[model samples]
Target: MTLPVSARMGGLAMAFRAMAYWLVRYRRTWRGTIVVSVANPILFLLAIGAGLGTLVEGSVEGASYLAFFAPGLLAAAALQNAFVEAGFVVNSALRRERIYSTAAATPLEPGHIFAGHLIFIALRLFLSAAAFVVAMALFGLIENIVVALAVTLAATLTGLAFATPLAAWAVTVADFPQLNTVFRFVVMPMYLFSGTFFSVEQLPGPLRAVAYALPLWHGVDLARTLALGTATLGMSLLHIGYLTALCAAGAMIARITYRRCLHE
Candidate 1:
């Protein structure tokens, strides 16, 4: 069963509409969220990069820790912002506030609710990335102005891809305890092992396979390579495809779960 052309377009329009709603409504959070996410990456850069740079004594990359760390900090924003937005906002609305019931009663629908959440998450990731780019400029992490915007766009998409399961899972959670376990067992492992802070080469041979298996790995690879001015066009498209597929699968699964839960 293939979707008709008109049906596909209409579905896309609805998703876009849902996303737009969150973007417009959350403009007020911009200033403060930016402050937190912006400072976070910087703190990581300084604490892990400079602090550890002293201990390594110029052996890790034969360069300053700042240079090696800029990419890691950028990738960290993708993981952090996406996770925070998904866990915090989704859990609050679905678990704490029961806002979804109210929203579901409206014309927006559950799918729209999901889109709205992802849109907000995507926007936050973009802002967080932008803030890091500025910090990078101050710290001399970037020389190419073009790569800054590229990194942000990549991070935005990648954030959504890596967060797909968490976002979808948020819809069906009977309680918050599961979320803690998911974060501890699933997301935390992805963050630590997915080349977020270091090269995948550092992974043990068996564990190296896990790095390539993660959506974040593709995103981080693309972001770092492009930001460094080394990636090919094909690589860029591959990363884009990976993120798109994850988002689509997530939305589809979420729709199924939401419809079953809400309609029943």
Candidate 2:
């Protein structure tokens, strides 16, 4: 049941290297990504959170629409940036740019390849979440430090849950536009309907059930409940279980797909 220390360190090292690759390989792009991630969340707050709050009633997630929705927006933004890094970036690197092929030509193993990309995703998540948190602090939206940490972690995990399989799925495509469709179709819709703006109870019965089924639904649930401190122990455990299961499932699917794509 216990893994060797060296094995664990090796995995960590692989992930570090993957994250480093982004900095070294595409320094300007990575910097721009950081800037964009930070800016996008702020814009969302001003445009949607502030603007739309005017039309709505009392509040959501315990605070005004801005406070209640801010962390969820942060979590969702982090989720988005993480997937964009792993799914689109990794897919292009592996397929179009043949980076994975080049790496495979060396002594590096397949698990390292997977770990490297995942590490890159994690780095993206951390940077994006941190930036969003800073924005939150500057704008005065946070209520609890523990809630802040929990929402950030939720954002990172939520991103991983979606990104791994999405990266694999991107391998089958011949053109980059397919990723655009995925964003517009899969990521965009899940984000819009995942109880981000209004409560899920606000949605009708069937739509509410569908939203509950989405991965981001549980993710936003964790973020929203934690931000507002509304979740009971049982509900918290359920949310964690849902996210963990989705992340595991995504990793499994990514592994199988990578084998098929990279095996010679």
Candidate 3:
């Protein structure tokens, strides 16, 4: 049965309340999240764009090493941090915290709870990407500051794409070891191969195809082009459409998974 409009609004309001609570709670631990977000681009830029860059004498795709690197790093950081926030944090809400249980007793539905978590994840990813953009700017890596908005949108959507699926899977995992295995085998490999540190064009044929299938590569490509002011509208739309599809599909699955997990 469908909920009435007023009831739906009430449920959404409860969801927003939950999202607000997360934002407030995050303030207490903002330092850790900020440090991690800031450190990733810096370490990668210093270690690769500056260090290994010294060895490679030519521009990558005609952009300086740091310029080519900045957007990819920003997108990768969003993927990593968003995966952690959505997976581990969602797991904690399901298990250690019993947050869903508490909310279930109230006016909120399981879908509302999941929606609230996704809202928080999206907001966190956007803010983190914006901060990283500023950091990249300070290092003189950004060619166009105006494109930060596009980069941030790409990063935010990319994060949500990962976040929803990870949240759904985390609900079914029996233990932390299983989750760690996913990171080791799945997340880490995507991070390394998704054109984050270098162009996927350098990858062998099959590997390049694999990178194209992954969501992060699309994000990296779009974000990098936006930062460099070189994206064609058609390509940008394709990337955005892929990420949006993943985000929508994953959110649906996460909603169903959350209902099952919370009910169990």
Candidate 4:
């Protein structure tokens, strides 16, 4: 039988409640989060966008390299922060802290638990992106403040595109070391090759193809375009579609994986 609307509403309430729990806990640790999510990215912007940007004499995509590079770093920082929350934190909740077990005993279903974490991840990315944008503004990198909204949204989507799948993968991991392996091999490589520092056009044909296949490239492109106010609507829609598809598919996979792994 189909569930009643009230029941569905209750499920959503439970999910948000679980998200609130995370937020409450995070408040105590917001300092570290700010340092990692906000400070580090700004430092990188200065180090690379300003420091190295000086040695570079040409414009990228008709803007200074600092202008071109800041947005990509914002998205990359979002992806990094979101993956940590969804991947390592979620895995710890399941295996180490066993909070999911306690949550499962309540009205919250496995899907609710998964959805709650996803929601928190989105929130985290938005906050991180906002902070990064403010930093960019301080550095005179942003042409228009309103563009930060679009860039933040893109960063959030980019983050979820990676986090959802990583969450599912985390559930199956045997130990912390394996997660490190994923970061060193997968995440780090993507960070380097996703057009964060340079255009994919600079890559060899084969490497460029690989960059095209990665979600970060799409995120970087969309964010760069939006931040620079140079995005064509058609291309922006295409990038949004690509990231949205990955997020939806990954969330579905995470739901299934959580059900199986958590025995929901």
Candidate 5:
């Protein structure tokens, strides 16, 4: 039977309430996160984009090395932060703190709980991405404010593409060590090879194929294309489609996992 519109709205209200729990908890710890979100990009831009950038000759994709590298780093940083939140934070809530278990006792369904947490994650990504873009602008890497905003949006999308699926898996993990293994083997390799620091074309054919399949490469490419104003309509659509599909699929899996975890 079709539920009434009021019922749907009520569920969404519950989801937002769940999201509020994270936001309120974040108030005490937000200062540290804000510092890292702003400082990390500036330091990277100085070290990698400015320091190493000078040693490299010629422009990359018609811009200076700083311009080329900043957007990729922005996307990469989003991915890393998203993973940190989705990995250890989510795991702790499930295993150590049992926050989800407590919430399960409330009126919120598993889907609402997952949605609420995912909403908070998206907010976190937006703040970090915005800060990174401001840092990019300080380096004179971005000319157009609109493009900078687009790059920030692209980075946030890139983060969600990884965060949702990782959160889904985090629901099932029994310990912290498994999360470390994922970071070491899965996330680290993607960070290195996903066109963040260099072109994926430089990789061997098989490695290049692997990079192409990863969401980060698409994210880096999309963000870089926006930052450089080099994106064609077709390529932009392709990248957005891939990232959006991953976000949707991951959210679905996360909902299912949350249901199983909470119900059990």
Candidate 6:
């Protein structure tokens, strides 16, 4: 069942072609995205970080509330963006627009199509994360360039960890309402409770355990640690390992789901 090395390389090259297709299509649709990606972080920083931060500054340990809050927001924002790009969009391609179907009609295998789309999503995550980091800098939330880049990388990894599995599930969904439910029940709850707005330690024992189990908490913790310069090698590796495992597992699942959907 193993393909030759040349064949594998060719499949990857085809996947890149599929990514290029999305990149070109994005040229027309990117304006609205850019506005949201760039402005949401800044507005959140102003309203919540600066405004609510003042009220809770004394309660937060070690750093100002804004400083404590900004990195977590960056991680949460990346999660949101990745979900938006992967959820309904993946569903639309499989159902309404039939983009994946169209690609399947060509020589491309399902894995190539999936990889291409995933790559494009990763690119989007990186751009959005980088923009948010810059906004953090403008507000003096991030001081070091290396730290800013590390935070950005963490955000992007956090995003892919969610995006891959979400896309896998999106392919199996029957309608838009199902995706809506996921956003409402799943993504929204994580955003509100995943150590983004407050510390997980504030939760009761069971809730704290649940928060630790969620990917967003790991992401928020990693980004905050890097931003605050409080990262220990062991803890950083743990966060990275958790997110990386999710990303790898999700990609595997997506490949299987995509192959089924495309063949059907």
What lDDT score is found at residue 189 in candidate 5?
89
lDDT of 3 by residue, 121-184 (tens): 8888888888888777777766565666777888888888788888887876758677778888
Instruction: Report the lDDT of model 5 for residue 185.
Output: 97
Q: List model 1 lDDT by residue over 1-264, tens digit each.
A: 998999878766776776775677577666777655778778877788668755765543344555666775677677777777787667777768776676677776677777766766777787778877777777776777787788778877888886666678776788778878877888778778777677788889889997888887888878777666677999889988988899889878888876665555
lDDT of 4 by residue, 71-110 (tens): 9998888779877888889889998999888888887888
- How much lDDT does candidate 2 score? 0.75
lDDT of each: 0.74, 0.75, 0.83, 0.87, 0.90, 0.91
lDDT of 6 by residue, 1-264 (tens): 999999989988999999998999999899989766667776887899989788883756478888889999999998889888899799999999999999999988999999999999999999999988988898887888999889999999999999999899899887789888888998999999998888888999999999999999999999999999999999999999999999899989998999999999
Superior by TM-score: candidate 1 or candidate 5: 5
Cα miss at 175, model 4 (Å)? 2.0
TM-score of every candidate: 0.85, 0.89, 0.93, 0.95, 0.96, 0.96
Over 4 Å off, model 2:
1-12
TM-score of candidate 1 versus the correct structure, residues matched by position: 0.85
Q: Clashing residue pairs in candidate 2, if any?
A: none
Error of 4 at 26 (Å): 0.9
Give the alpha carbon lDDT tens digit for every residue of 18-118 in model 5: 99999999998898887666677669888999999999899776788888899999999998899888888899998999999999999989999899999
Task: Score residue 36 of candidate 6 by CA lDDT.
Answer: 67
TM-score-superior candidate, 3 or 6: 6
Q: Count the backbone clashes (under 3 Å) in each candidate.
A: 0, 0, 0, 0, 0, 0
Instruction: Summing lDDT over every window of 10 consecutive residues in candidate 1, give the lowest-scoring window.
Output: 57-66
Rank the candidate models, highest lDDT first: 6, 5, 4, 3, 2, 1
> Which regions of candidate 1 fall more than 4 Å away from where they truly are?
1-36, 54-64
lDDT of 5 at 15: 95
> What lDDT, from 0 to 1, does candidate 5 have?
0.90
Candidate 2: 10-residue stretch with minimal lDDT: 14-23
Which segments of model 4 are wrong by more than 4 Å?
Answer: 1-4
